[model samples]
Target: MYSEKLKYYEFFAGVGMARAGLGGDWQCLFANDSDQLKRQSYSDNWAGEAFDSRDVAEVETTDLDGVADLAWASFPCQDLSQAGSKAGIGEADGTSVTRSGAVWPFLRIIRGLAEEGRHPALLALENVVGLLSANSGNDFRSLCGALNEIGYRFGAIVADASHFVPQSRPRVFIVAIRREVSIPAALRTELPQSPWHPQTLLRAHAGLSVEDMAAWVWWSPGAPPPQKDFELEDIVDLSDDADWNSEEATQRLIGMMSELQLNRLAAAKAEARLMIGSLYLRMRPNGDDRNVQRAEIAFGATLGCLRTPKGGASRPRIIVVEGERVRTRLLTVAEAARLMGLEEDFVLPETYHECFRLIGDGVVPAVVRFLADRLLEPLAKHAKEGVFTTINGRKLA
Candidate 1:
């Protein structure tokens, strides 16, 4: 079965979350990331595995052990995200020259593999949903065009982490198959589907050249496997041993909230059982349109998407209410890991910041597994049978 249960290369492989999601069955031939803390955590959890800690720019073709059945890359999204600088990976003509430009190196490695006739049968890219509109949609076109130039047909699915976890993170997965690999028509839809193909995605596709559109497939991976509701309260660490904030600190947090936020907290406090809430301090406009810091809390159901602590407010604080008492604390590394769909046994970074950043930068494993079960497995099955589809584009370079 596709070289005995599929093999993959994990690029920009932040802490091997993709590998964790893919699980033990899929052999990981190579993995690379530049972060020291992430490298340490990844090595700890995935010992005896080939883990390359070099920056993507420093990665050479020889570092790759062999041709993989798939390559999953979760490249940097800071430049493309609103939480960071929205500078983006530049335009179609050139990409970001900074570290955020890691996607280009990722593409280079894939292209290099193709040149050596060792290209993987499939490639999956995960990044912030902002990729769809980054640089006014040109970046999306460039990515699609690059795959086309390398002789692959591709599509995108906007998978939200909340579907599989209690975190409200929506990421875009650009799943591509080499032109020669046979994908059944069942995976394609004549019309764009909702949720996966949002209006922004449709607009991005319409802006593409006709040639790229022809190479495009509106991937229909079917509804995600029915997952029971994963609520904010379900994954939280509510025991007293948790690093709950002190009485003074909790009161200070409450003091910073606006009227609306206080009302939400009051509503949550009125609930029949203990309440779990997540808080994020953000810059919002006052009556005069002047920016002011405000505390915002999501009372139930789901927490806002986790973000690395680029700023103090970027990290979320958790609040708990039981009877007449309330407590608050920074999101613990353990809770952060669970929010990312990591099991309790998974080794995390040593410090809170490191672990939080690792989890924040990671993709949800359960979501990945869901996609693997429905989309990737079928493609591999078709590949093993020598099911063939012809390429309509000429290979470049």
Candidate 2:
């Protein structure tokens, strides 16, 4: 019965990155997002099949297609983001506010489907790592409680995009399974795993209610294969026409750097090869205790994380240092797409705001593929075949 291609639903689907990550092997039965521009981008790329453009809050059980094996939701992170309001997810009674509140509707949909006996076998919710300690850990507990009320057992793993791409985006993925489903012991851990389950997550688990703690799972997706031997130069274009800031502007930016940052830039200049780095504007207290906007330079094996470009501070700047030369420019749309591990031919939104935000707010398809190929698919197969027992680490047929 599980021989057919496993199917999924993409909730909070931004530009269908989840669909892309799931690839052609897994069938995407439906995709939903409230943002119209994101939907337009998805439509252009996906031919507008099985998509709901309305807010998830407005979506009901009847709006979805038939039951799916998995449901993926990369809900908005504004409220839960450490960089944002830090408002948390609010009370779990469905009175969610701001974008972070989107999770409420997402959970509501799952409950709605469950009421009709159409809930997915697995639920994967992706959010910023801040969700681990939001509201002194109460938010995380509430989130799990909501899932428990809907008849699911949940665990989480924190995965960073830098493992697969030239960008540093650490996100938390909470995977919930219907209680009746039997998880393959090989795919779970008796305790939190290193790197995937950090101290904050451990603390959050410690805070769960007795019943919820009993229902908690410790997922073991396993380590992904070694990353590609790629660098910033591979994803970024530095040609003359690629919007490099003028020499004067570049010098002004350099001047804004503190002594420590300039020292870092000088160290980069000493390198033999042309190196690319990211620069951002931050407000720091000047000598007189007044806040002054300063340009901070960051360089490493990967670029900094991508964020929605709502203002100058939110938009990232690329810094190129080849010997004595220093140039800076806003990150390009194509570059942002590449950072998110999108295909070269992927159709991006017409405007930068829509295109950049979609990528920033979306999941890395490569990371999704890693999770699906490693744990999700195998878990689904085991559950469907009714392989409820494992003897000496082998499945019983």
Candidate 3:
């Protein structure tokens, strides 16, 4: 094994979801978050005492002198968020200079490492899509400038959880390698070329500038995963004796539906009772074929991006019903853990609200595994090949 285990430090460690995604293949050496409750939750799941509830900006590099190989930070994205106030800009020290400059504190960690000549070999960052356009590119430019100053080479990609699971959460991931190490020229060249070079509109109100736009590269959607023709039969979780009477639910659903949709539901309900032994909510995705996946089950299909504010519980879980005797409930958190490729045994928080909130704000474990197996592994191997021995050994001062 190149490493018996890769060691990592997790910043903004929310309930240790990233650690859950990585599994036990790697060891977490240091983790920090400001939330006392989240810190306790992180401790409950992982075997470590490194959970420090401190403002990350206040964390000094000397405090983490010989800790880990990689550093992961899923910083707060509210300032650059599309759904929230698009506050931008922070002071040089990274305190939100404006009402919405949360990213600065995140960047400050890297800046501090650069000053101390103790930056990690690998840095993985996650954020919202709005970051691509925040502050007319000033925020991003400053970030790039910081990394450049610290001798790091960075690349970014936007991936949706739906690629691996059924959730369509598109997030921006920025991966960086210490500059002394040789980044695979081939890897850079092989990245899918993008044609959708849209200017990121950070604020609905901000002026457009030439450099504020990011050229988005497109990847051919991967092969669709196999699916069973099992309708609601395979996953429904109602008790054997549970009653299905919900006139109020029916009425409310009807009330919420548009007139056209209400008509369809009424017709479908009536048609099923008259003709078939079973009533099914038949659904299919756009341009779907019999050979294609059952693209119609709204819940199983790609879910919309999970938002921090609109937690998993706030949303109604979806259910697919086929007949008087068949129905599948929206995925439970345990099932969601499986889709995220998390270990079934991983402990979750007891608080219902916290559990959903943490999951919503988490990095998909599969995504982290991909970064570890596909990206970080290669970088680590290349570094061990003596690509940056001189660079790595030099002190920043």
The model with the greatest TM-score is 2
Candidate 3 pairs with clashing backbones: 194-217, 279-322, 283-296, 284-296
Which digits, one per residue and each the tens of the lDDT, describe model 1 over residues 358-392?
Answer: 77788889889988888887786676567443232
Error of 1 at 26 (Å): 1.2
lDDT (10s digit) by residue, model 3, range 1-397: 2656777788888877777667676777788888776777677777656677888767877667463567888877666666556775555574556533544665666667656666677787787767667776667666655655666766566665665665566677767777666666534533443311223422321332333222211222233334323323222344544334365653444344444544544454554532111111222233555432121223334444545543211322443333332232333566445545456677776555556666666778776766566666666656655534433366321
Q: lDDT, candidate 1, residue 49?
A: 78
TM-score of 1: 0.91
- Give candidate 2's error at residue 170 in angstroms: 0.9
* Candidate 3, superposed: residue stretches over 4 Å from native: 80-83, 88-102, 135-138, 190-245, 259-300, 310-316, 321-332, 390-397
- Each prediction's TM-score against the native? 0.91, 0.92, 0.73
In candidate 1, which residue pairs get closer than 3 Å at backbone N, Cα or C atoms, i.e. clash? none
RMSD of candidates 1 onward, in order: 3.3, 4.1, 8.3
Query: Global lDDT of each model?
Result: 0.80, 0.84, 0.56
Instruction: Give the lDDT of residue 166 in candidate 3.
Output: 53
Clash counts for all predictions: 0, 0, 4
